[model samples]
Target: MTKNISKEIPKEKRFLIMVILLTGVFFTLLNETLLNLAIPVLVNEMDAAPSTVQWVVTGYMLIMGVFIPVSSLMIQWFTTRQLFIGSLVLFSVGSLVSGLAAALPYLFIGRFFQAMGTALLLPLMMHTLLMLYPAKKRGTVMGFIGLVIMVAPAIGPPLSGVILDFLNWRWLFFMMLPLIFLVLISSIFVLDNVTTVTRPKIDIRSILFSIFGFGGIVFGLSFAGDESVSWLNPSVYISLCVGLVCLSGFVWRQLKSVTPMLEMRTFRHPMFSLAALLLFIGMMTQFSTIILLPFLFENALGVSTVAAGLILLPGAIINGAISPFIGRIFDKFGPKILVIPGMILLVIGLQLFIKVNTATSILMFILLYTLVMIAIAMIIMPAQTNGLNQLPAKYYSHGTAIFNTLQQIAGATGIAFYVTMMSVGQNLYPSTSGIIGGAGRYSRCRDTVCF
Candidate 1:
């Protein structure tokens, strides 16, 4: 049966499947960051505080983090087509709910639904890609996936800025509705089941541990930067401690269980472990820059929101455009050559920001930012593909799920850590001159702290 199915799937059909999957994945990811600029608008319109309104973003991240661990199990239980179509439908409904939301609570609920769909979509796409392509060809294919990952978030702020220039916050969701519905409908006809489904018994305890474990950590880290939430507060410490304990239990349960929720044994491979570490660090740095750059542009350099977005746009575009080529290089030469140089470039790019001051040129900023993007383009996809390549076919879904979940956690933690550092620096310095005198302090602090 597997042989027949493989023979029946022509190259064109495979390409079409990729197109459909990438379309769904792209829009879902695009929606993830689209609402960032709209937060202020939502806060004012809904008469909610910044922290309360932030649940729109936080809720999505939380749900995604919580659900990602189970995605490995879900893939085992469901057909690819079934999961793909269901995720798209769920995403469409969530978008509709958010677009038509009458209050803050409705928006949060909608965002939660959106997140559920996204959690499935991300790992599903990667798992499908791994199934369709061989390891040798994976670098090139994953590079395109890298394009989606890198470009979507990068363009999100600018895209939102442009949309809000003429339209309101709700239109953000409304505009996505048609595209999502179109993709959802198309996928129904073209998508086919790739992974063989095995009916595994759902472990209820594992589910609870996963929810509290992952959810608690992400929630605590996300709220760590809030002025109202102190590091010394019980809520913060309690959540982190509970998260750690539950996650430990979850790990122990997985090791003993007949069918683990996620295959922890993937880490037994040295290459996979190293790749995961590199991916984690890369995600942390990428997210920190995403959070920090806009503030530096607008607050310190006096650039407009639109201008800041514009400044970041070109670098993202170039980075995304070149990703496929980088993937080809990875396929031909392998990761060692690409990753080492990429890391060097990455460190150099970060170092450039260490001495940023009032006199730093926007042109220089653009160049350095583009360099960072380029370095990330070279590293992220190749490292991820190489890591998964080390795993056996049976572990594909679990491997992808584990890697993605950690990526999300890293992103949330990075944002929380960097924001807190920035806030503390602001409080300690209290004036623009004070900040400038210690202009290199922010980057130095981040280096010492995060690295």
Candidate 2:
């Protein structure tokens, strides 16, 4: 049960390996959210519409979603060193191409390559961590992974604001270039293959199903409410329908496959299933808040972009900084103690947002938002660790891939739902004057119209 295969590896070697892996993961995650604030800048500079510029972000996510299922297969086929180095190379090259891109096409292509790398790297890192650490120690290591996940996105908007204040948008990629190169170089020296590779016969049909399934669903949801694409568009519905059908086929095939691409048996464990459900719900709230808060700050309250980013900075920092301690707590006490209170706090924090208005104090917003961040820190890592712990060592790759893929889907769903809600809310007001008459009126009337 203790999968202590890493006992042969020296403690220093293990530490160094983890350091390199963490460094790579940190930057990859940072790159994921880095371009969010720069979308408007790209629109003006590249002469692209908002909808078109959004594909840069959406395309990246789409590729990640599509390719993530294959990662379980890839980890099984390749050594840890091979996948890690390959991911870094792909990410580095993509960053360079994006940084040098003179047109929107080149930028999109570069993002695609970046997504490929991220898809591989995410699962590879998690699987490697599970291999390196024993079950008892995984909570602490995963907490650090949680820190990377929380902190990178937190830094993205503010970092973008500071960069755009002086430099061109390309610096977003360029600034990361050297750090990436350093990690790539160090990884060559430090990283080792921990998992035994078994070359499973590649199922072309399953691969196609995965691509269409995840890709179609994500693409449809991502553009669901775009100005150029109506939610009621036949193409959107077609895509979702195709995605759902293919995804069903993919699951069925996995359940029946002699050597499944992604092990479906992980769900048989009650605790694992429950943990996944909690993580999915938690992600919906986390991603929705992340997308909605900037709109409220910048558009509703007339706060500057820089000020908006700064306002959220403290809470993000606090969220990440406390993750390690939360992980330790999860180790001592089981997940229920941490996750239940965390869920309650998350609900309370979200409910508090119902009262936010033009007159709401910035300090109050920060406090409530920080409380939500704390809840996320408490839930995300603990839940994920607990779920994966329920799996046998052989299923680590599949479990991590499924967990990450679901998280991506959940985030996309959250963003789409919240943005659509905001749009519908604004439309209900009927005029600019009505929207501006009173923030409280707009808030109350948006969801339920005033007679």
Candidate 3:
């Protein structure tokens, strides 16, 4: 979309700039899903129940959903340096707190703080990059940023697995401290202070509407599977119902607001909205894979924790390694070439997942999983590039915030759905062999029904 972008950059300075921006994105994206593998370990170590463990993931999503709508306001209020440094500080504090946390509630609080910080990094990095790069190269610049965001989470699970196996669950949070410090130090020198009030005012009512509306939907989706077990649960219905109602109100309020937190009008641009939708889908499947992988390893495949983690490491590394190259492709070929294939590859990867079983070979499993990661790398950056290109320059920051917010929400939805489906299936088919035996069909199912 940035048809006339430039190719000129001093190699040394280019690398430095990229490092600064990528460092920020790496942490943001890592935080998005790094805990995927750690969730199981947390449950085992903390002696927590499934319902309680779900909150570790859900709470992070809740905080992210509630606070993300206000990022535009924060950007408008604070200087770029302040925002960047502030986000790192907040996120780092959260990491430390989570690392030392002895209870689930404290960990949730830590995650909440962590989400607050992560929510800002995405928008600020984009804004910072746009400031540094000339307009001609904005797409190229953002493509790289997108690459960082995409690649980090791709590898996080395997990395988390390895860490959890060798060290402890707390390392996941502790690991981030150094990265946060590096980004903080980098921002001190590399970041520029450029805050302007010309954008829009922070309307309290609009912010509240969006936060509650989005938060409610996320809350409901988070519990949809677990709640389905009890049809008469008022809280379940209340969460879903209130979430829908509030979201509707949020839409109405945004339309009426003179200075809205989100720029809903941008959706009038078809390309922008479609790209956002693709991003939603991309995030949905990506997280679905993330949620399902551990189960495949633990329950279905019977792989040890370390071995399963090792199996995943190659794919993660490859995806992370390939992201920068994918960014460059966006510069050369545009997004359409990359996105369609990426989506197809993603579907192929997920399809491979459907075949997994306890008897499946490890190498084959790794190969299929690696293909999925490749698909993820291919689609994610291109989709981001396409979405950003859809907006005008003035709205880019808010647009990025909105896109990332949708991505986070979509991921939350995907995890919820995947978990819910698994829970439902496990319940519905409990002791399939026994059911077959009772039905006098045990002979028919001896070979095919157990798996």
Q: Which pairs of residues clash in candidate 3, taking residues 3 or more apart in a chain or in different chains?
A: none
The parts of candidate 2 lying over 4 Å away from their true place are 1-3, 225-228, 434-451
- Write the number of the candidate with greater TM-score, choosing between 1 and 3: 1
Q: After superposition, how far is residue 348 of candidate 1 from its true place, in Å?
A: 1.1
In candidate 2, position 304 carries an lDDT of: 89
Q: Give one digit per residue, the lDDT tens place, for model 1 in 138-225.
A: 8899988988888887778789999998998889999988898889888888888888798688999999999999998988887785
Candidate No. with top TM-score? 2
Candidate lDDT scores, in order, read 0.84, 0.84, 0.70
- Model 3 spans > 4 angstroms off: 1-17, 31-50, 134-140, 162-171, 194-199, 225-233, 351-359, 431-451
Error of 1 at 351 (Å): 1.2
Scored by lDDT, model 1 comes in at: 0.84
Model 1, residue 116: C-alpha shift (Å): 0.5
Q: Which has the better TM-score: candidate 1, or candidate 2?
A: 2
Clashes of 2: 0
